[model samples]
Target: MTVENEIELTAISGRRSTFEGDPRPGDTLPSMKDSPAVEAGSTMTMTPGLEASRDQLQLQENEEHSIEVLPPVDGGRQAWLFLLGATYMEMLIWGLPFSIGILHVYWTNTLFEGEGASAITLAATLQTGLLYMSCAFFGPMFAALPRWTKTLQVAGLVIGSASVIASAFVTKPWHLIVTIGIFYPMSCACYFPCATLLFEWWHASRGFASGMMYAGTGAGGTIFPFLMQGLLQRFGYKAAMVSLGVGYVVTGLVALIPIKRRIPLSRYDQDGISRIRPRIDWAFSKRKALYLGIMVIGMTSLGNFVPSLWLPSYVDDLGLNKPNGVALVAILNAATALGNGLLGWLSDRMSLRSTILISCVGSAAACAFLWGFGKNSGVLVTFAIIFGLLGPSFSAVWSKIIHLVSKDDPAVTALTFSIFAFVRGVGNMSSGPISESLLKYDTMRGVIGAYGYKNYGILLIYTSITILTGGAAGLFFNKIRDV
Candidate 1:
C-alpha cells in the first residue's frame, strides 16, 4: 500500500540513478498525516550502499521538536568566540597544508634533491587527501558522541603536532609521507565537527560565519609563505619543521579553548552510539541535482590544486628568485581569503548556480589567458592572485549547493556533505599524479617562454579545460534553478 505523500525511489548497488526536470512517473510526496506512528527514541540503521530511500517528506519546517532549550542562535559571545578559534586554526594549522608549495619546492631542489618529483608530490597529495577523507569518518563520530568533542579536538592536535615534529627526522621520502602527510592530517580531522557546532550556535548567520572561517585559510596562505620562507632559508628544512610543530603545540591549545558546544551533553540522544562508523550512505543520491553536484565537485577539485602544486617550479623556470615565488604564493593566498568572503556572500543573495558559474568562468579564464601565456614574474604573480580568488573559493559555496539539492532537509544535508567531501578528496589525491603526467615535455625550455611553452604548456591546457568542464557540469543540477 502506497502512502499519500511518500516517494519511494530504489537504488541499485554500485549504480547511480539519473533525474531530469520532472519527477519520473509514480512519484509523490506523502503528507505527514499519512505516515505511521513511531515509538519515541527509536532509531533506524542499515547497510551502507544497499539501502533504499522511501522519503517521509517534510517539505517545510513548520515546527521544531526538542526536549531542551539550547543557547541563542545567530549572535552571542559564545558564537563569536567559537568563530575566533576556528579562524585561528584555519590560519595556522590548516594554513600549513595549503602553503605546502613552498616546502614542496625546497624538498625537490634541496632536501630530497635529485629524487623523482613523483615521490615528493605524493606527500602533498597524501596530506590533502587525509585532511578531507577524515570528514567522512569523523563527522559522524562527533554526532554520535557529542560529549567527546573536546577530547577529540585535543587528541587530534596532539597527534598532528607530534606527527609534524616527528617529520623532522625522516630519512626517506616515504617517511615524510607517513609523518607529515598522513599522521598530520589525521590530527586535523578533529576540526570537522566544528561544522555541526557552528550550525548549532549560528543558525541565521551560518553562511557569513562559514565565509569568515574559510577566509582565515587565505589569511594563513598570505602570511605563512613569507614566514616559512624566512624560516627555511635561515634554519634549514628540519629546523623549520620542528619550529612549526612547536608553534602548533602552543597555539593550538589556546585556539581550541573557545570552541564550545551550544547544546548540553545531557540533552543529546546518544542511542547505540558505539555502532557508528564513517558512513557511505548514498540513499539520497537518487536526486538528479545531487548526482550532478557531485560530478561538478569532483571535476573542479582535480584542477584546484594544480597552481599550488606547480607555481613555485613554474616561476623557478622563469628565472625568479625564491622570494619571488614566495611573494606570488602569498599574493594568491590573500586573494583566496577575499574570494571566499565575496563568493559566500554572493551565494546567499543570488542563485548558487551563478556563484559556481563565476568561479568556473573566472578560474578557467585565469588559467588560459593569464597562466598559459605567462612569461615573467609580474604575469605569474597576476595569475596567482586571480586564480586563487576564483579557484579554491568555489568550495566556499558548497553549503548553498547542498541546501538546494536537499531542499533544506537536514538529514540529507549531512550525508550529501560527506559524499561531496569524499569525492573532492578523491579528486584532490588524483590530481597530483595526473598533473605530473601532464608535464610531459617543454619544447620552449629557456626560450622566451611563449604561451607557457617554456615548461608547462600541456599542463596549463589540461588545467583550464578540466575547470571549464566542471562549470559545464554545474549547469546540469536542476535544483539551483529555483533559487
Candidate 2:
C-alpha cells in the first residue's frame, strides 16, 4: 500500500497516523475523513502497514513528550538558588586547596624546614588530587543515594573541618598529609558530586551555570589566601586551622539549606535497588569523543597546579617577600573568578571548542612570555593575572563536554562526568611529582634561554608546552560536532 493509504488505514483503525518520511518542523499530520459509524463493541482489524505506521507515530509522540518535560534552561527561581548553593559549596570545598600555596610557603619556612619542595608539595597534591578524584569515585553514590545528599554533605563538612583542626596538632608532614590532605579531600568528595544536580536543572545555560559554580573556587582562592596569611602571621598555624574549621562549619551549614535536587529522588530508584550499586554507562565509556576530551583535559591539568602551588614560592625565591607573593596569588585567583564566569558565558554563546582553544593558547602565552622572563615583581604579577584569567577554570568546559557526549541525557551526563573526573584526577595526581621533578634542577638558575633559565624556568616551559599542546588538540574536536 502507498504510505498515505497506510496512514489513513491506521487512522481508520483508531490508531495514530504516521508520515511516510520524517515530519518537517511545524507540519501537522493528515486528518481522517468522516466514515460510516460502526457498532459500539465492534473491533476493527488493522493491516501490517497500518500497525507499523501507528507504532512509529506513537514512538514519535512519546519522544516529543519527553523533550517537553525537561526543565527550563537558565533564569528561574529554583535554578538561581541551586546555582547559589552550589557556588558556595564550591568555594568551601575547592577554595582552600587553591589557596594552599600560602600554607605551602608557611610549612616550608617554619614547620617543615628541612623538607624539600617535592615532599611538601605532596600534601597539597594529595588534597587537590583527592578532591578531583572523589568526584569520580563518589558520583555514583550521589546518583544512587539522592535522598541522602544533604546528609553526606554534612558528614563531609564535619570530616573536613575536623581534619583541618587535627592537622594543626601534627608535628610531622605525613601527619598533615593524612589529616588534611587525605581526610579533608575525602570529605569534599561527598559534597562535590552534588554539583551534578546542575545537569537536571539547566540545559541551554548549562555552561554558564557550571562556570558560575566553579567560580566559587576562584572567589575563595582570592579571599582565603589573604585570610590564611593574616591568620598564620598573627595566630600561627594551629589557630588558623581552628579558625578555618569554625568558618567551614558556619558556611557549610548555611549553604546546605538551599542545595537540593531538581528532580525527585525516587526517579533514580531502579525497582527499589540498593543505593550502593552504581549504574555505569559502559556505552559512553566507549565513545572516542569522551576519551579524546579526557586526553585534552588531562594534558592541560598537568600544569593546572603549577601556578597555584608554586607562584607564591617563586615570588619569594625572587626576593620579593611575603606580601608581594600573596598579592600575586590573590591576583591570579581574582582573574580566575572572572575567567570562570566569562568563559562559561562565552561557551554558551560561542563554540565550546573555540573557547577552550582560546583559553589554552592564552594561558600558554602568559606562561611563556609573562612568567618565563618575569625577573621582576611587576612582570610576575601581570603573569599571575593573565594566567589566572586563562588557566584553572578549564573545569567549566566539562558542562559542554557532557552535552556533546551524552546528548544532554541527564543520566548519561552524570556517569560521563564521573569518568572525566577520574581521568582528569589521574593527571592532577601526577602533576605534583612532575612539578617537583621539574623544580629539581637549580643549575639553570642563571641560564639565558627560556628552557635553560634559572629557578622555575624549566617548570614554566613545561607548563607552556603542555598548554599549547592542549590548545592544538581542540582542532580534533570538530569531528565530535558542537564541541
Candidate 3:
C-alpha cells in the first residue's frame, strides 16, 4: 500500500478495530460491528509483515555469475593441470609418512633393537601428528596473512628436503625421531594449506578433486614400501633416506610448475586486500555436521594407524616373510587410493551420510570377518584390500562433511576443513600411545581377528569398535541434523 494509505490506517487504529473478530496493527481502524466506535462497514486490509522464516531471506547471493571478466573456474585445462601437480605433491610429501609402517617394522626389529614399541611408535606419531596438527597454522590464518604464503611454501620445501637428507646420518633411533619424525613433517605441514587452491579451482566437483588429491598419499604408499624395502635391504636406511630426500626436492619443484590459482590476480592486489577469499567461519562450531565430522574422522584415524603400522608386523607374527608384509601394505595402500576415488565420486551423487556409513560399517565388517578370522596368507591379503577399501576411505567423506557444515560459504568451509583435519591429526598422534597400551593385551583371544591375528586381537577389536561407532554416528547424522 502507499505510504499515505498506511499512515491513514495507523492514525485511526487507536480508536478501535472491529472489521472482524480481530484486527491487525496495520489495518485501517475497523468499523465496529459490535461496538459503536465508528461506522459498521470498514474498507481496509491488513499488512502484517511476512514472517514465515525466522531468518531474513536472501541475505547473501552467489556473485560468480556477475564476474564476467574473471578467469575460468570449476573446470579448464589449467585447473586439471593444477590437480595433477597437487596429486604428485601429495605422493611425494605424504608417500613416506603414510608408509611409515614399513619403517616402524625395520627400526623396531633391526635398528632400535631393544627399544620398546612405544618408543619406536613415537617416531611415526610425530611425523603424522605434527603434519596433521599443522592445519591449525595456515589454512585459516592465510586469510589474514596471504602475503606470507609463497614464502612459507618455499621455506617448507627447503626444510622438508633437508630434514629427510639429515635423517640419513642418524646414529640412533632417537636421532630419527627428531629429523624424520619432527622436523621433516613440520616442514611438509606447509603443504596442507595448498588445498585452498584446489577449492578455488574446482567448486562444483570438490568431492572428486579432494578424493583424487588424497589418493596421491595412497599411491605413494603403494610405491614407497617396495622402494624403501629394497633400499633398506640392499643399501641400508642411510642410502634410502638420501635417495628419497633428493627425489623429494626435484619432484616437488616440478610439481610446483602446475600449481596455479584459478582466480585472476593482479600484482598490486596479490597481497589479497581486494581479493574475495574465504574467512574463518566460526558458525560451523554450532552445527551437527561439524561434530559428526569430528566423530567420523577422529574414530577412523585413531584406528587407522593400527592397521598400517601393525600389518607388516602382523605378517611377521604369522611366520610370513618380510617381503610378504611389504606386499600387503602396498596392496592396502593401493586399495585405499581406489576406495577414496570411488567414494569421493559417490559422495557427489549421494549424501555424505550414506558414504560415511558405507565406509565405516563395511570397514568394521572387514575387520570382523576378514582380518579377525584369517587362516592363511590369502585371508591376510584379502583383509588388507577390503579393510583398505572400507576403512581408510573414510577420508573421502571429509570434503562433503565440510560442504554440509559450511553451507558452501567459501571462507567458512575452509575453516571447517582445517578443524576436521586437526581432529584427524590428533587422532593419528594419540593412537601411537593408545596402540602401544593395546598391544600389551597379546594374551587375549576369541574376539574378532582371533585366529591368525592372535598378537593383535585386542588392537583389531579396538579398530573395529571405533570405526563402527563412527559409522553409527554417520547413520544417525540425518536424524540429528534435522533437529
Local error of candidate 2 at 237, Å? 3.3
Residue pairs whose backbone atoms clash in candidate 2: 444-454, 445-454
Candidate 3 displacement at residue 350 in angstroms: 1.0
Q: After superposing candidate 3, which stretches have Cα over 4 Å from the reference?
A: 1-68, 105-120, 233-236, 264-279, 442-455, 479-483
**How many collisions per candidate?**
4, 2, 3
Which structure is stronger by lDDT: 2 or 3? 2
User: For residues 1-483, could you state the per-residue lDDT of candidate 2 as single tens digits?
Assistant: 223321222211221211111223443333222111111222233443434467555543453112112223466776787789889888888778877877887888898887755666777778877877877767666656655778888888888888888888887777877886789887765456555777766767778889999899899988887888889989988999998988887888888876775543222224665333334456777776787788788889887668876776776766776347778878888889888888888889888678888899999898888877777777788888888878988878878887677664445666677777777788788876788897887756666534454457889888888887877787678776774
Q: Which candidate is the best by lDDT?
A: 2
lDDT of 1 at 290: 80
Tell me the whole-model lDDT of each prediction, alpha carbons only. 0.69, 0.72, 0.69
- Candidate 2 stretches with Cα past 4 Å from truth are 1-72, 111-121, 267-281, 321-323, 441-452
**RMSD from true fold, candidate 2:** 9.4
lDDT of 3 by residue, 1-483 (tens): 221121212212321221122345564432211221222233334455423222222321221112112234556687788888888888888888866877888888887788756766777778878787777765666555555556666678778899889977767778877887778876654466557667666655777888888888789889987788888889888888898888888888777777754432222234545443333557778988778778878888888767877777777777876347778888999999988888888877877678888888888888777877875788878889988887886776777777678665545655777787788889887776787788876666554445334557777788888888888778767765421
Assess candidate 1 and give its TM-score to the true structure. Answer: 0.76
Q: What is the C-alpha RMSD of each candidate to the true structure, in Å?
A: 10.5, 9.4, 14.0
Give lDDT tens digits, candidate 1, residues 1-483. Answer: 222343221111111111111223444323333222211342233334323344522421221322222344667676788888888877776777877877778878888898857777778768878787777777556655555778988899889989988888877778878887788887654566555456545544566777777888889888887788889989987898899999987898898888876543322124734232323445556667787788888899898878877777777776777446667777888889998888877777766667788999999899887877777777777888889888987777776666556544333455567677788888888888898876876644654344445458777777888888899888765444536
lDDT of 2 at 184: 89
